[model samples]
Target chain A: ELKVEQNPLFLSMQEGKNYTIYCNYSTTSDRLYWYRQDPGKSLESLFVLLSNGAVKQEGRLMASLDTKARLSTLHITAAVHDLSATYFCAVVYAGNMLTFGGGTRLMVKP
Target chain B: NAGVTQTPKFRILKIGQSMTLQCTQDMNHNYMYWYRQDPGMGLKLIYYSVGAGITDKGEVPNGYNVSRSTTEDFPLRLELAAPSQTSVYFCASSPQGLTETQYFGPGTRLLVL
Candidate 1:
């Protein structure tokens, strides 16, 4: 059983600020993914970090993985209202199966 | 390509009731998965299928069943509904390669009373 822990489960930040959400896993797997979900909506894939030093950025969001430490991160830059959603990090368990972390609810206020 | 689609966007059922949640994807993905998301919690994998006629249980599978009969469709059956099963259900699919970038369906909100 893989245990995944995320910090600061609820984040309230102002627009134009920056913050990072951390995901720590209990296993040795290089496949880590980030996803975002709006209220009452399905999840949308953000980034897939496949290597220890892999970093991917889209729009104002960036995700990185440090497989050696079993950790991954999702960073928000210049936060906007549209980024107010729950973000989750998941690691592949086996053969395309994934185990997800407790999401971080982000609220960006102007 | 419609990506992934699920039927019955919302449903309310009583205890011991049964229903089958339908999922289909036009991407012709080889791997399809079923997940349930409770309020304020991460999505938990209920079941997954690698290909037609192949299926496996995931992290949480009790009281849920799934089948894959074609490359595009995977249906999950709930035989005995319980309050614990009340949650939003999502269906996702991914290619067989290494990336495993999953595309998700809108979701089905089920409430067991």
Candidate 2:
């Protein structure tokens, strides 16, 4: 069974702070994806990491993948209240299906 | 394009009732999937189709059935609803490769009585 785990399931940070959300999978996979979901809303695609050491950035957020370690991280820089949301990482297998992590809920306070 | 669209944003069903959750994507994606999300658990794949006329089971497939009769539509069927089946259902579509990004719908919230 393929399992994806995210660390610091609940995060509370203040504005201008920096934090990283970690996602580790139990299997080897070359594809990883990050998504954000606000309360009662659909998921919004954040980043897609296709290879080892692949890094993608969007606004104040950056995501990196380490395929060798089967790990992915979403780094938040100078976070703001508007950036508060639940972030998820998914591991993709050869079958072209995604197994999602439990998700990290970030609460950024002013 | 509407990306991925799911109908009946919300619904309440009585036990043993049957209903279908409709999903369609205009991106011409060849892969469609259905997932269920609980309160704190991650999304679990229920069913998926590689293309039209090809459907397969996923991690959690019991009590659920899916059919992909066309490239753009994939509908999930709940034969007999139950309390445990009440969750947010999301339909997603992606292109045919493993590197493709899956586009998700707004999701359907179902509550079983």
lDDT per residue (tens digit) for residues B1-113 in model 1: 68999999999999999999999999988989999989889999999998999999999999999889899999999998999999999999988833768899999999999
* Model 1 misplaced regions, further than 4 Å: none
Q: What stretches of model 2 exceed 4 Å from their correct place?
A: none
TM-score of each: 0.97, 0.96
Q: Global CA lDDT of candidate 2, please?
A: 0.92
For model 2, which pairs clash? none
TM-score quality measure for candidate 1: 0.97
Most accurate candidate by DockQ: 1
**Collision pairs in model 1:** none
The window of 10 residues in a row where model 1 chain B has the poorest summed lDDT is: B93-102
